[model samples]
Target: MDGLFTYNPAMVKAALGTHMVTGYAEDTFITIEEISQGTTSKTGCDGETVRSVDPNTRFSVKLTLQMGSPTHKYLLNRYNRDKKDGNGSFPILINDLTGKEKFSAINAWVTKLPTNTKGKEGQNKEWTLETGQADFQIE
Candidate 1:
């Protein structure tokens, strides 16, 4: 309406299959990146330019969670399942209740497990997932 808007991290919801993700890391919670693997443009000797599109819709999502959290355990289980049998692909969805931002992926899998470091305190675990195609919108 006017210049009054509210935002809260708790309003945002993220899920992988039936598991709801929570216990996000304090530093950075989540990040999504679109992977581009095609060509952009090429210029010829004269003044002609060739433009092309890759039409690649691949994307990746990174989620940082508290170590030993339930979310981390869920992802670890999925990763183990995938490594064992290769049937661990699942759907992912992220929705921002404060705004109209949303991200959805029909097919996604964990790229790799998070590295562990032993220190005085428990560190955060970062889980990375790659998707064949992802539908994302921000406004």
Candidate 2:
């Protein structure tokens, strides 16, 4: 059965590649923007009231971090260095906190990490898949 459920925002956990952001250890991370598990879409025919089974799943994460943090520097360097590498992809893990779960994109890259920010805000880091889904599990 499907029904609405309540979740705790503080339990949202994330990691980049092999880094853990759950604060369970020395290496931890956080996001200021809203985080989602992902989204799905299906192919459709023109003028047809039905949808096909071509699923399009992409997980796009956007968050702001303090301008001068160590993470900010590392992500900035990584983004600027590999923006043009066609084969570059960054693995990410996002846990909803009920259990330990992980997923890596089929193909992924850092899309945005601006150097500027709002009057008193921080920088944003966002990643979106190029040609695959973001729901693959890690064992």
Best of the candidates, lDDT: 1
Off by over 4 Å in 1: 37-39
lDDT of 1 by residue, 34-115 (tens): 8876569989999799989888888889999987679988888899999999988899999999987999988889999888
lDDT of 2 by residue, 33-121 (tens): 21343344554576545434434556555434444445554555556667665444656666666434455554455676554645655
Judge candidate 1 against the unseen true structure and give its global Cα lDDT, from 0 to 1: 0.89
**RMSD to the hidden true structure, all candidates:** 1.6, 7.2
Per-candidate TM-scores read 0.91, 0.53
After superposition, candidate 2 runs with Cα above 4 Å error: 1-7, 21-48, 84-88, 98-106, 118-131, 136-139
Sequence-dependent TM-score of model 2:
0.53
Global lDDT of each candidate:
0.89, 0.49
